[model samples]
Target: MLMFASSRVGSVSAGRISNWIGHRYTIVVASTIFLLGSVLMGYAHAYAVLMAGRCIAGVGVDFSLMIAPVYSPKISSPSSRGFLTSLPELCISFGILLGYISNYLFGKLSLKLGWRLMLGIATVPSLALALGVHRMPESPRWLVMQGRL
Candidate 1:
């Protein structure tokens, strides 16, 4: 619940910040925050700490969700932009399905370790996203907005 609330707020603010800076940097920031949140949740010693981590992760999730569609179309060729823009939504659905599968697999382990692993696993992809985006060109629309084009 708290996570969802924070995500809503974060998405709105992230849009404004993305416009000021650029989508690439914004996504990097989002991934970093998500990584931190995942780590925090995995190591949480109390309910409060877990909730705090969830809230942070929520914001990160929303930021990525809000920006990916905008960023993909801006960088893709017109003929492919429709497919590229839709990828985010498709990926999100797949991610949720994966999460459920992960939970089922992890549930067989000891409670303490299983849940931690489930939460921490998210950091792997977030780290990859943070690193991978660095090599990609910035959205052309953002470059034009910055008067670089």
Candidate 2:
């Protein structure tokens, strides 16, 4: 519930920030936040820390969701726009399926280690996103809007 609340708030803020700083940096920011959240959750010894981590991660999720749909169409050719726009949804579903599998596999470990490993594993993709965002082209529409192109 807290996650959902924070996410809703974050989505609005992310949209504004993306407009100001551009979507590329917004994605990097979100990925960095997600990495932080994963580390916090992984090392958490207290309930408060876990909740904090969850809130941060929720915000990151919202930021990504808010930006991607808007950004995708701008980068894709008209003929491919429909497929490209749907890719995010497909990836999200695949991620959920992967999460379920990871949960089951990690659950087999000792309780203390299992949960930590499960949460910490998220850092891999988050880190990849943070690094990869730098390599991606900024939305051409955004560049034009900003008079940079």
lDDT of each: 0.90, 0.90
Q: Candidate 1: minimum summed lDDT over ten consecutive residues — where?
A: 1-10
User: Model 1, which residues run further than 4 Å from truth?
Assistant: none
lDDT of model 2, residue 116: 97
lDDT of 2 by residue, 20-129 (tens): 88989999988988888899999999999998998998888888999988888888899999998999999999999999999999999999999999998999999998
Clash number for model 1? 0
- Cα displacement (angstroms), candidate 1, residue 136, comes to 1.2
Instruction: Note the residue pairs that clash in candidate 2.
Output: none
Superposed model 2: Cα runs more than 4 Å off? none
Residue 124 lDDT, candidate 2, scale 0-100: 94
Work out candidate 2's RMSD over C-alphas.
1.0
